[model samples]
Structure formats: C-alpha cells, structure tokens
Target: MKAISYSRYGGPEVLEYGDLREPKVGPDSVLVKVRAAAVNPVDWKAREGYLDPVLDAVFPVVPGWDVAGVVVGLGASVTEYAVGDEVIGYVREDFLSRGTFAEYVGAPVRTLARKPRNLTWEEAAGLPLTGLTAYQVLVKALRVQRGETVLVHAAAGGVGSIAVQLARHLGARVIGTANERNHDYVRSLGGEPVTYGEGLAERVRGLAPEGVDAAFDTIGGDTLKVSAQLLVPEGRLVSIADGDVVSYGGRYSFVRPDADDLTRLAELAEQGVVSVHVFETFPLERAADAYRRNEEGGTRGKIVVTVAWDTAGPDA
Candidate 1:
C-alpha cells in the first residue's frame, strides 16, 4: 500500500511517500480503503513531536486521524458496518502509527460513523475532528442554551465555523471573532463578526452588551484571557487550545471519538444545519504540502488530502 509516513518526529520535511504494509484489522476494527483524509493542526504538531508525552510514537508513523473512506474488510467482531459501506472516522488509536494518511486504516468501531450523504468525500473527511470539537464544547462543555449570546474565538477557522453554526442551531445568538477579511464569512455562518486582538473584549461586549452567556475558544493565548472577561460573572467558558483555561474558572476540552456524537454531526450536515468548507485539497502524495499550508494558518476552513485508489490495488 502507498502511504505517507515519517520514521522520526520532525517537520513536514520528514514525511515520505512510498509503499508500506497494509494495516491489520483487529477484532474490534474495520479496514477502510482511504478515499480522503483531512489535515488538522494536531497532525503537524504530532509530526513535530509535540504530542509525544501523551501519545506514544512508533517509528514510520503515518500522521492523520480524520478519514472518509469505504469499508473494504471488517474484523470478526465488527457488526456496525460491512464491505462497501462509506464511513468517516476519527481514527486515533492509543498509539501513534497506522493512521489515515495511508491507503488503508484499521479503524475501531467506536471511531466510525456513516459519512453524511450530502457531503463529498473531502468534506466528509474534514468534519470528524473539527466538527466533534465544536459539538462537544458547545453542546456538552458549555451547555449553551436557547436565546443566550455565545462568543466563539477564531470563528472562520475549521472548528469555530462549525461552532458558530451549532450555537445558532441551538437558538443561541453567536458572536464570533475573526480577522477583518473573514467578518462577512463569519456572518454567513450565522455569527455576528467581531475582529480579534487588542479590543476583542470590548467588541464582544458591544455585541452582547450584558456579557455573553458562554464562550468557546479555539485560539489560545490572550484570546482565552479575553474570553474570560467577555463572559458574564457566571458564564460558562471552554477552550480547546489552552489548558490554562482551568485557572480562569473555565474548562479545557479535548475532543474524543464518539460514534453517537459523530452521527449527530452527520445528521446536522444532512439537514443543512452545518456544512464544512474545504479551504483546499491535495493529492495523497502531496500531504506534506497540505501540512505546510495548515501550519501557515489563517485558513478559512479545512484542508483535505484525497487518495486515489485503483481497482486492481492501492494506487495501482
């Protein structure tokens, strides 16, 4: 099988495209013939060894977690899906290796969900991680309610865009921060746009007047600090980027794989309540380029890497 992998932790420069053995399907996993994979900041961060303390890295690591693909084979114990089923997964295992950047991935059933029929493979690939992050933070962590005003940091980026839509779906008024260029994009996602930096708190205050009922921060640093002040005295706040949010009486949320949650997100996509914007797409072999683009930041949506499979074999 052809895959992109690195034998050592480094930058995108370390990534190599070549043949590798196909992943094994365990009792609780299914083998997905990769159609497309999405690049998240965590992909590049993991490549740079930032997640080493928490995720064990094996040599020749394949670096991707979000995949939209077809099930080609299934484990003896797998019953949720079968051959020919199109699925999307956040295929993060307990260790770092055998990831979705390959022609195939052995995804545990817990990580798999039926891909939204309304989305293209690239868009479906983009949704699992970022969509789940937004859904979990707003719906579960912050418990945003109807008629509430909520603030989302980095609202034009992947997760924040989804957060904006989800908050609006829940009947909350969304105030989102982005650059001046993305202000209209944020508004299109149903958020009242506010430019980030220096006076973010004041801008949010002007939008909400009485302070926001909840805040979801995807950008760290002083943005989280600003979120703390923009919230009412007892408002809920959560950050996916900063752990120090705990110190500000807010929660730090790390996205986890939940088939039920992923299914709900798919439902939202199918219902036209939320949609993924693909900022760009690259061929599988050009994954390193995708990583470089993601690292450059300021992307309005997700970046996807498409895998072309030959009927005879993997990229035959």
Candidate 2:
C-alpha cells in the first residue's frame, strides 16, 4: 500500500511517499480503506517533532489525526460496524506514528462513527478533529449558555470555524477574530467577525462593552494572555495550544474519541446544525505540501488529504 512517512522527525521535506505493508486488525479495531483525511496543526507539529513531551513517536512516522474511510474488514471482537460501513474518526495521536496518511489505516471500532450521509468524504474528513474539539470546548469545558457573549480566537481556522457555528447553535453570540480577508467567511459561519491582531481586546469591549462571558482560545502567546483578562468573573477560558494559562484560568485539553460526542457531531452535520468547511485537499503523495500549507496559517477552514484506494483485496 502507498503511504506517507518520515524516517526521522525534522521538516516536511523528510516525508516520503512509498509502499508499506498494510496494518493488521487488533481484536477491537477495524481495517479502514482510507478515503479522505484532514491535516491539523498537530500534524505539522508532530512532523517537526514539537510534541515529543506529551506523545512519544517512533519514526518512519505518518502524522494525521482526522480520517474518513470505509470499513473493509473488522476485528474478531468488534460488533459496532460491519465490513462495509463508511465512517469518520479521530485516530488516537499515538496511531499517527503510522497514520491516516496512507491508503489504508486501522481504527478501533470505538473511535469510528458512521459518516453523515449528507456530506462527501472530503467534508466528513474535515470534521472529526476540529468539530470534536469545538463541541467539547463549548458544550463541556466552558458550559456556555444562551445569550452569553463568547469570543473565539482564530475564528477562520479549522477548529474555530466549527467552534463558531457550534457556539451560535448553542445560542451564544459569537465574536470571531480573523483578518479582514476572512471576515466574510467567518460571518457566514454565524460569528461576528473582528480583526484579531493588536487592540483585539478594545474591539471586544466596543462590541459587547461588558466583556465576554467565555472564550475559546486557540492561539497561544499574546492571544491567550489577552483573553484571560477579558473573561467575566466566573467566565471560562479553554485552550488547545500549549501554554501556562491553566495556572491562571479555566483550561482543558481536547476531549479525545468519546463515542457519544462523535455520534452527536455526526447527527449535527447531517442536520446542518453545523458544517466543517474544507479549504484545500491533497493526495497522499503530496502530504508534505499539505503540512507546509497548514504551517503557513491564514487558512479559513480544514485542509484535507485524499487517500485514493484501488479495489478491495483479501483481508490480512
């Protein structure tokens, strides 16, 4: 099978496209015929070896977190899905050491959810990582209620795009930060668009005047620092990026692969309660290029990698 991998962690240039053996199923895993996968900040960060502290990677690593695919075979112990179900999932971070950047990847049955019938694989591919992150942050971490004002930094981003829609759907008035170029796109996602760099706090004050009730902080550094000060007395601040803000305010690492959450997100996608926007798509052979684009930033939504597969063969 063709897959993207790096023998040593360094830059995107280290990624190589070549043939490798297909993964065998574990007792609780499903062998998925990869269709589409999305790139996240973690993909590039892992490629450059930045997450060595939290996740240990053995090289010849394939780094991707979001996967949309069809089940070609099932583990002996698995019963949630059959041999021909279509699904989408957040493959565990450790699994990315040999990830969805391949024609075939194995996902545990617990992580896989039926892909929404309304979306193409490309769109479904874009949802798992970002959609789940946004859902968990708003519905669980902050517990944002209707009529409250919520600020979402990097609002045009993969996670933020979904976050904005979910916040609005939950009845919060969402104030999103993006550059002038992405303001229209952010607004379409149901957020009030605002320029992000410098004087961001003042802009929020001018709009809401009473400060925000809560914030979903995706950008670290100055953004997180500033958001902390903007929170109301009992407001929440949750971040996905690495930083020390937990010592100062509300914080939670994204909730991983909760079957119930994935199921709910799938239903929302089908119902059009929210959408995952895909700004770019690449073939597995161009995995290096995909990571480079994600690192450049300013993207309005998720970037996906299409893993093209041939006809099914005998199962391993």
User: Which one wins on TM-score?
Assistant: 1
Task: Point to the candidate with the largest lDDT.
Answer: 1
By TM-score, how accurate is candidate 1? 0.98
Per-model TM-score versus the true fold: 0.98, 0.97
Tell me the deviation in Å of residue 219 in model 1. 1.3
Residue pairs of candidate 1 with colliding backbone atoms? none
Residue 202: error of model 1 in Å?
1.3
**Which portions of model 2 miss their true places by more than 4 Å?**
93-96, 314-316
Candidate 2: pairs in clash: none
> What is candidate 2's lDDT per residue for 24-106, written digit by digit as tens?
78999999889999999878887787877778787778778789998988899998998889999988744347588888888
Q: For residues 192-307, what per-residue lDDT tens digits would candidate 1 score against the true structure?
A: 99997787778777778899899898888899898888888889989999999999999999899999999999999999999999999999999999999999999998999999
Looking at model 2, residue 280 earns an lDDT score of 92
Please, what is the whole-model Cα lDDT of each candidate in the order they appear? 0.92, 0.86
Off by over 4 Å in 1: 313-316
